[model samples]
Every structure is written in C-alpha cells, then in structure tokens.
Target: MTIASTLRLSLYGVALSAISTLGLIGCSNSSTDTAATTENSSAADAEKPAKSIAITQIVEHPSLDDMRRGIIDELADNGYVEGQNLTVNFQSAQGNTATAGQIAKQFAGDNPDAIVAISTPSAQSIVAATTTIPIIYTAVSDPLGAKLINEDGKPFQSNLTGLSSQLPLEPQLDLLQQIKPEMKTIGYVYSPGEANSVSLRDSLKQALPARDLTLLDIPANRPTDIGMATRSLQGRADIIYTSFDNNVASAFEAMTQAANELKLPIVASDEFSVKRGAAAALGVNDYDFGRTTGKMVYRVLNGEAINNIEPAVMNDLTLYISPKHAKTQGVSLPAELLKNGINVDEQAQSTDNK
Candidate 1:
C-alpha cells in the first residue's frame, strides 16, 4: 500500500463524516422549531374560551321560527358558528306561557353570554329570570308596555336590550283602507293574555277613530278560541285584521278559514300571514328583526354594556299581497298594490300543515 493513497482515503472518510454530522444537526433544529410552533398555536387556541347563548320563543309559528333561524344564521355569518366557538341553545314554549316561564328559569341557570327572547311573553319571562344575563328580545310589538325598555326605547337598566316589531300603524291602516276604501269597521283578533297584543288593541282604539274607522275587538284567550272569536266578527266587521298575537298566530289558519267562509278579507301585521291566506300584510320582516337582534347580541358578547346599546325598532316596511288569497276572501287588491307589493302567488297552506 502506498502512503499518499492511504492518506487520501482517510481524508475522504473524515469529510463524509463531517457532512453527515451537519445534516443531522440541521434536521434537529428544523424539527424543534416546527414542534414549538405547533405547541404555541395549540395554546393560543386553548386560551380562547368558547362563547354560548340561549334563545327562547313563546311559540313555534312561522314568524318566530324565521326569526330564530335568522339569529342563528347571523351569528354564523359573524364567525360565532354553532358547534364551534359559540354554543347556541334554543327552546320553544309550544304556545304555553307557563312553559315559557319554566324554560326561562332553565336558561337563566345555565348563564349564557346572552338570552334571545322571541316574543313579548318569552321576553318578559326571561327578563324576570335574570337581571345579569344580557336579554336580547325581538318580535315584541311594544317594548315599552313589556317594560323591556324605558322612554325613547333605551334599555331600562339591568342587562336588557332588543329590537321591537312595533307595527307602523299609519302604513298598515293605509294598506287596509286601500284594500277597502269603504271599510267602516275593522275587526281585530288578538290575545288579551299577551302584553303586546293588548298594547296593539289599545292603540287601535285611539288610531281608528281618527281615520273614521271603528275597531271591533275580538279577544281570544287560547288558540282554539281564535276561530270562534273571528267568527263572532261576522256581519259586523267589514274586514278582519290580525296582529302578531302568539295565541292567535298559533291557530292563524283557523281564523283565516272562518274569514274565508264569511267572505271577509284579512289585513295582517306579519309578512308570514300573507302566506297563511291573509289578503295583504304590511309589516317588517321578522327575520330581519331577528338578524338586527343578533347584531345587538354580538355587540353584547363582545363586551358592550347592554344598557349602552339603545333599543331599536324595525323600520323598513314590506307589503305582501296574495291575489289568490284576496279573491278567496271576497276582495280584490288594487292594481297599484299588486304592482308595488311583493306578490306571493303560491297557494297558502294551513299553519298545522306547514
């Protein structure tokens, strides 16, 4: 063996060993950095607490149902998705006020970020349940009467704020008058048990006389009574008018059935009622009201004080008319109304069937 060749072979082996050592060190440093990054990311995610909210509704009618769905959708759009960073718990009272009270108690105990009350009854119940948990209410016709807010629609102390479904009486009455210019008597079917309905009924008494229209008040104590109360208006009331009374809304189909049989047209304060055989509806979309309520909730969950957020009312009025329904109820909508209003041509199904 030659000495020079032996030396060359030994140097090559040493060089190879040095390269392998550097490669191993580079791999160790890369792995450590990647693992640290992953750990820090996990810790950050863990630090973010999961937010939750509870929602309650007086009944499961289409208006309230759409409101609830809109709230959920609004939250989802704002990144507080259900089954993710936010937890949404919803319950319906099934048209029972007592059951509403019970559900409010349950939700109050849970102590979520906010409680969304759909109707006046549920709003009153939840407000009674907790003074601390933020209460965001919607579909309430009169927040003042419900005591959810004080003067000028500001939160009445405690954790309370909401959007009101207070009907724009002038526009609604105008729609009815347009439908029947000779409507001397307007019959209303409402539930006295609900504070909003009673508020609306009282308001009607004052507003109708100014317009030269007399109001025939038909008070329905229960869902079953809605049909009978409506039938009683026959031969007296020139047309049937309905507000967003939970009980009356629960059996709205029955009332519409009797109205149709009596050949009486209906003017409603809920957009959903047009789909339930009302001749026309002039009111705010409850779903939009729910979404607005959700925005209020988002502000609350983000740490804004409840009272700091002033209560809002549904402003934009949408008119809906069903030609088929109007004809069935012995009235024909005006040509301008057919052109201006949202024309719903689909046949109306009963509340029970829907």
Candidate 2:
C-alpha cells in the first residue's frame, strides 16, 4: 500500500468520527428542550385554580336562615369563599309550597354542585325536582316517613343526605304532664300540608294515651284557619300544644291570643314559640342544628362522598318556658322547668293581666 492512500483512509475515518460526535450533541440538546417544556406544562397545570361550586338554599325562615349563614361561614373556612371560589343562590318560598317547588325546579335546572333544603316541604320538593343533584337537608322531621330516605337513614337511591329535626315527642309530652298533672285533655293545632306537623301530631297522639291524657287535634290548612281551629278547642282542652308547624307558627300571635282568652296554657316544640306565648317547651336549639348541618356541608363540598356518611339527628333537646304566660294562665311551672327557661320575663306583665 502506498503512504498517500493510507493517509486518505485515515482522513475518511476522522470525518466519520466527527459526524457521530455532532449527532450525539444534537440529540442531547433536543432531549434537554423536551424536558424543559414538560416541566413548564406541569407548573402551568399546578397554577390553575380548581372548579367553582354552587350551593342553593330553599327558604328564608329564621332557622333556615341561620343554616345558610352556617354553610357560608363553613365554605369560607374551607377555602370556598362566596363570589371568589364559590357561588351561592338562595331563594325563599315565603311559606308557600308551590313557590318552594318552583324554586327547587329552577335550582335543579341550574345544575348546582349541591343543594341544602331547610324544611320538610322544601326537601321533598327538591327531591322531586332532581334526582341527580346532591341534597343536604336541615330542620326536617322523619325523613323516613316523608320518604326522603330509607329506614336506615341512607340516601334514597339519589344523592340525598342531611340532618333531621325529629325532637323527641315523649319528652315534650312528659314535660307537659309534669307541668300540669291534672290536665287530661290537651289541644294540638297543626297544618295539614306540613309533614313535620303530621308526624308530630301522630307522635303526640301515641304519647298522650300512655299518660292517660287525650290530644285534641285541630288541623288547619292555612294561617287563617289556625285561629278557628284553636278556638274550636276552647273549653275542651286544659292546655294547648303547638308544634313547629310553619302555618301555625307564622300566626302564633293569633293562637297565643286565643289561648290567652281561654286561659289555656301553651306547650310548644320550639323556643321561638315558647317566647311567643307557650308556657314551656321541650325542644331543640335550631341554630345549633344549623351549625351542625354546616359541618356536614363542609364534608360534602370537600369531595367526601355523602353515601358513606349516615344521616344525623340533632338531638340536643332544651327546655324553655315563659314565666309571663305561665303566670297569665294561672299555671305554675315547677322549679326544674324554670331552671331551663331561656328568657323569663319576671317584670313584663302578661297580656292576660287586666
């Protein structure tokens, strides 16, 4: 082989080695650029905010109003602030069932993340309106009997769960018996459309018989009918029992006035009614119930599956009595009853005073 031919072959080998080195460098640069791009994409995804949720409420009553406040407060505490990360649409039925149903249907159409129904009628209407949306109810009585849930307090095939306001009937009846041992016949005024009232009436009927007493039920369909129904029981009953019937409660003044005229003491199922004119009440603190319901809302909005959470009962029973009504009706509450009284008006004379 000649020296010149050998030098040409060495030059060709050097050229191939240089080309391979350049190719490797170019591939390394390409890989670096791809890694940087992937990292940027991940950072962008992390910076994006989560989805916004909508919460709808059905009514504007005091108990329900408190519940709404609780939910809003809870949402804010859990990083879901209204007008920022969340949207809240609150509507009121004004004690009208038809309007409640309409509001529920409209709410369902909006496809909110969750719905919080306040009362039995509102919950029932919402349940009827949508089976897909999740419903969390408060201040409802006997969800099982109302067909809102199953016997085990599980969601009713749909995504419905909530807290119940089923205050114990036996306690209230027993308290009434304690306050007025001689009282054999008690009058109960309720609204026919209210499921809570119906359940309470049935419970009272069942409870009173065991105490050797009779419950005189007066069913009123509207607020106007309450006065007449209550008046019908004027002389027949020694005392009157008022449930948390919205119809009866809205016109509480009328019932109290009638009872005052007849000199009949009032026993109620809520503190608000007791403040109005009921001599005493063995009931639940509705505001506390609201706070509890708010916690449940927090769990659901935090992505916790509601199916795993059982329905809760707000069983904090409190006894309240009005000294004004007690004195006006000539009914003396026991010392134990007065101990649990929330607001006792010792100075404010009863309207029954001449």
Candidate 3:
C-alpha cells in the first residue's frame, strides 16, 4: 500500500525484537541470581552443620532408648542443645528390618548434618545407604561381624565411626555363676538376624565350655515369637542368658514371663534388661556407650574427619540385680553379688530419671 505504512510496520517489528531481547536478558539475570542464592544457602548450611542429626534404632527397647537419650545429652553438654541450637530427628524401626532400611534411605536423602544408628541392623542399613554423609553408630557388638568394619580394624566407609557395646566376658560369667552356683547349661535366646547376637553366641559357645558350662542358644526369628522360643528351652537349659540382641530385648518381658512359668532365671547383658525383668545383667552402661558415640559424632560435626576417628569399644561393665525380678524368675542373687553389684530396683530409679 503506502511506503510510510510499511516504514511504521518495520519500526513496530524492531521495537518488538528489542523488547524480546530485554526480556531474555532479565530472565537470564534472574536465573543466575537464583543459582547464586542456592549456592550460598548450601554453603551456609555446611558452615553451621552441627545443628542437625538424624537418628534411627532397630527397636524401641530400654537400652537403646537410653542410649539415644545419652547421645542427645552428650551433644547438649558440648553446646548442641536441642530446641535451642540443635535439631534432632529420630526414628525407630520397631523390630522390623524393612522399616530400618526405609528410614536409612530417608536419612540419606535428607542429608542431615549427622546420622546416629543405634543397633546393628539400623547401622548396616545406613552404612549401605550413603558413603559421604557422616554416620555414628552405637550399641553395636562385634562391629567386625556386623560388617561395619573391615578385618583391618577400620570403618568400612570413611564417613563411618561408632562405639561398640562389647563388655568383658568374665564379669558376665561370674554373675551367672552367682545366680546359679550349680549351673551346668546357660540357655540363650537370641535373634539370628542380628550380627551382634550371633557373635555373642559364638563367643559364649567357646567361653562357657572352658568353665565346664554349656550354651543352649535358641533362635527367635521374630520379636513376637521370643516367648515361645523361651518356652522351648524348658528341659534343655538350667538358666537363660540373653545378649544385646535387638529382637530378644524388644520382647524381654515376654521371655521373662515364659521363664517364670518354667522357673528359669534370666541373666541379661545390660542393665536396662535387668530393669525390664532379667534376674541380673552385667554389661557396659548403654547410656555411657551412647554418650561416647555422641562424642564421635561431635568430633565429626566439629570438622574432624571421620576417617581420623577410629571405631571404639566401651569395656567398663557394671552388675545390676533386680531381686524383685529375680524372685519372679525363681533365682536368689547371692549375698556377695548383691553387696558388690548395684540393685537395679532401688539404685537404678535415680539413674532412670536422668
């Protein structure tokens, strides 16, 4: 039509192109700013990493629950106070291994500042879930047998370190003898799925025979089946012994009930078990074991490399007798043993309040 109209159309086209260019430039700037902000946020989180911890346990037993409390208390003593400066996330597998694995995967994805695994199953799950995030485990016996550590005595992952609950065997055996002076066979109820229990069972097999005592280990595949397993040991064993097996500990009350029906006394490996119903327990203080684990976690969070901190074992053992529980289990704790050991029913009330 008209040259002037064509010129106007060209100008409009040019203006549209210019506006589009400006819009593209603004979008680019916005994207760059967002990326930079994200990077800065991540770096800030890295700098203040002692603020969060994710914890998981295979079961909700007194020993493991106490250990978790000990971990938090230890961290608080070192300045990472929960609800003030620290955030703690905890999950319990409730004696299910599949749940343990699911919790481990969640913790790995959440990428917390640190992870605390309370039992062998939970520890194995988390150790398999991630290799970069720092992990500190506690209440595990036979770390090597659990495959958390290699034969070289080093953690399998550079990011892994922990505390072992392995206690001296002599004290445990002595307590058993005190409970049953003429004991010929020591019956043990354990979880075959747990590495710690298997390790302890093997050790007892060798250690007991040296003292002319034999071990009768019955496997309870599930927590609910523990009482039935205990009843199975009726004619075979003189007294029942239990280690730090997560499954057995979770259902200890049931086992004690069955044992009471059979007039069988139970000798447990930890003090918390004594509180539940075991006639006596001689093992490491689970809370102290957990506090020591917190120290390792604190070191890792405080910028210490995890590989530099080796896995440790707490060996200090204490005897705890529940005469009330003993009476129910048809065993009388020796007078000398009662004088030497802590009465869990009386003295443990103070410790439990903490």
lDDT of 3 by residue, 156-265 (tens): 88999888766656667777787888989999888989988899889998898789999988888999999999999988899998888888888888998999899999
lDDT of 2 by residue, 235-297 (tens): 799888876677887788888888888888888867667767878876677666666676666
How big is the positional error of residue 346 in model 1, measured in Å on the Cα after superposition?
5.9
Task: Name the better of 2 and 3 by lDDT.
Answer: 3
Error of 3 at 21 (Å): 63
Candidate 2 segments whose C-alpha is farther than 4 A from its true place: 1-60, 344-354
lDDT of 1 at 26: 8
lDDT score, candidate 2? 0.70
Superposition error at 300 for model 3 (Å) = 1.5
TM-score of each: 0.83, 0.78, 0.83
User: Which numbered prediction scores highest in lDDT against the true structure?
Assistant: 3
Top TM-score hit: 1
Q: Per-model C-alpha lDDT, please?
A: 0.79, 0.70, 0.79
lDDT of 2 at 27: 13
lDDT of 1 by residue, 1-354 (tens): 211112112111212222122111101111256878656544543444578999999889998998888887666555466785789898999989999999999998999999999999999999889989989888888888988887765677568877776666776777788888898999998888899888888898999988888999988888989999999988999898888888988898999999999999999876789888899887777787677677777677667787776666665567788998899999998887877777766433343457
| For model 1, the run of ten residues with the poorest summed lDDT | 22-31
**Which is the better candidate, 1 or 3, if ranked by TM-score?**
1
